[model samples]
Target: MLLDEASIRRESEHVEDHIKRWMTVEGHFRILTALSTQMTQDAISVAKTSPLVSELYGRLLTGSALLQLAQSPIDRVQCSLDHSGTAGTLLADVWPGPCVRGRVEHAQSTQAPLYGGDGNIHVSRQPARGGELYQSVSPMHASSVAGALQHFTMESEQVITFISLATVVDDDGQVTMSGGLFVQALPGMTDEDLSKIKGCLAQAEFEDLVVAGDHPFDASAAIFNDVDWIETGTDPILYRCRCSKQAAVGAVRTLSSDELAAVRAGATETVTCEFCGTDYIVSAVDLDAS
Candidate 1:
């Protein structure tokens, strides 16, 4: 699907404005993130219908646009995910600073050792290696997106982070859309300051705003109330895959000669990317040349 760049830009600006407002009250480094419903639904649909993807079920799509206050204007970070079921897994990539790239997997079986009443979440920094395990501690004996994300924040060692997430699914079990709000206090923040920030977050009517389809900035404003904020800049968030045909072929070439020959002998050889559900067909001629 084609993205309306103008619309995305407007939404991004709205989120950034909220972050700036929050920063005025806290007066320190912070990261604020939000996602649109359309972006979330599209991701969930891909995960549910893609022939090559199967890790998530009964899932929701979540998107995030991160705005960090710094000396160099605003540092933007984007995150998107399609996850579901009692237990699931995720792969992510990490960049410099607080931006992380990796996967999160929730254990499917309630009987699993690591299963907390909710689910067992496995976060892998390396896609090849499994990941560190985090068990949920939901008092109500149910799994929740917000709960899972809170676990992630603690495990990742982000001090003083507040997250508000909500999802809407149609009766037919299709996700209509999803969105969230995230705020994090940077290091060196005093406990007193953190407590005040948390107080503001606690009083914010996040669920109501989200349900009403309010802009993310509005939610931030509710949390910061009357604080004067500056407008930095905006950035777009998109769901895209980095897979390429050449990358697929390169992977096939890594196999032993015998394995390569076996693949070439088949009527059709194909490789599918688990991340984006993209298929790449392998050619016998290409295999022979390698």
Candidate 2:
């Protein structure tokens, strides 16, 4: 759902972490700006990832949130990256609540650049009303999650999209800032108009946007100071997991029967939610009841 200008202003002022969306008066450029400080902190706290992985995870979360803005309010979006590198894989989900959750696996090297590996970006959208799932995968840009995501959207959705993402973490392994912006060429967009947006982004740069101010207004005004645009919607970026005790136990049941028997022999099996790090137990009684 789209928020009115009043809600947009209220949310932007009250929420430190949220995504703000807009379209140009010319109807040629669709834009989204995100600031995800609290969201990143929540994800990092749950993952307990190394500083490098935390940064990568934060970017993935931001990317997912941006993509979600393109979806109908009822839809949910998920993005994943699997690489042939020591850095490992990343997964993130964004839903109608504007909340995000994710996980990273097989991180063999904290120093390993998130790039320099054969990797693919996979994306999918789930219809809230229940329907066939939409999925696509594209080669990774490797340079950054934002690059890969931009490539994926352009190639898979066949739209010209310019995206830039960034994550900043302190020496204490705390995420101080995390977010980015994307300008997508709409149906009526002309090459010149697209170029203008690109040029604006090039001049503004992600660094300057944040340096001047990380607020949505500050960044949007910095990048499109002379342009006319109206707020389309705004939603707070929250970190919430869908994991439940039943879902957790159901996951444990997915193990092979032999494995299940062995786990049940212990009388209790602990299952951890990958997204939020919550734990659930499957006792012998639970198995017998099942």
Candidate 3:
């Protein structure tokens, strides 16, 4: 039941379409969700451990990664959860175009404090490399998936009024579904308008809605029942890897001349992408050409 490239593209389009439809103001806010039982199963299969641990990792990774994309114009994002399941790191990039990158790491525990103190969700945002257009972090006391994201929006430099995020991993570890909703107030929005929107979002019960609906759009519609919104555009998102044989050869070229000679004397060198587990082989002739 593994998803092929075509299937992955289809799912990506579905999620992107929903997000685009939920947009109200241009670049002011964004809502995105992704659901993939096959991808979840594939991710957990790599662990080969307890179902509980695998499920937890898959859920957190999916939720946090989606939230990261909601905050910036990042086209690619990667997240790595700690072995203990209490901490993780997120890396985001725009890749090939402008090449902006940022990283955020967080740990939560009473004894080992990474950010501020115990039970304090201390998150940090590294400065963007290419431009200063995107740089912000939200640190709050709540640690749940929804709470962390809400804090992220509230603490961002953007004028975000409300955000709701929810994720559910099936009990049997067979399915993973995640939904995120973002609401931002444009310039000149009055305090009264912000307050009303916040009140509506507070009463939305987005978590329950996500669990009940079969799709991200359904969940979003339920969350913002009274808001007037329309479909704008779409962008596809998939668990894709930016790795290839040429990239592998370039990597080998980075080694010292002596190392390259040694590699030439041996078998072909194979490089594996850590993100998507794709392997690329570089032959001796390829290295010689470089």
State which candidate has the highest TM-score. 2
Candidate 2: 10-residue stretch with minimal lDDT: 207-216
- The clash count of every prediction, one per candidate, is 17, 0, 0
- Angstrom error of the Cα, residue 115, model 3: value is 15
Give candidate 3's TM-score: 0.65
lDDT of 2: 0.78
Q: For this target, which candidate reaches the highest lDDT against the unseen true structure?
A: 2
Q: Report the lDDT of model 2 for residue 153.
A: 84
Answer with 1 or 3, whichever has the higher TM-score. 3
Candidate 1: count the clashes: 17
Question: In candidate 3, which residue pairs clash?
Answer: none
- Segments of candidate 3 deviating more than 4 angstroms: 1-18, 21-71, 74-140
lDDT by residue (tens digit), candidate 3, 219-250: 56665666666665443333333567788899
Candidate 3 lDDT (Cα, 0 to 1): 0.49
Ranking by lDDT: 2, 3, 1
How well is each residue in 1-290 modelled by candidate 2, as lDDT tens digits? Answer: 98898668746553568788899999998888888878888888888877777777888898888887775567888899988756677888888867788887743347666544787888888885678898888778757788888888888779898887777778788877677787888898998887788788877777446644465456667788867898988878889898887886787788888878887688567898777778898875666665
Residue-level lDDT for 223 in candidate 2 = 80
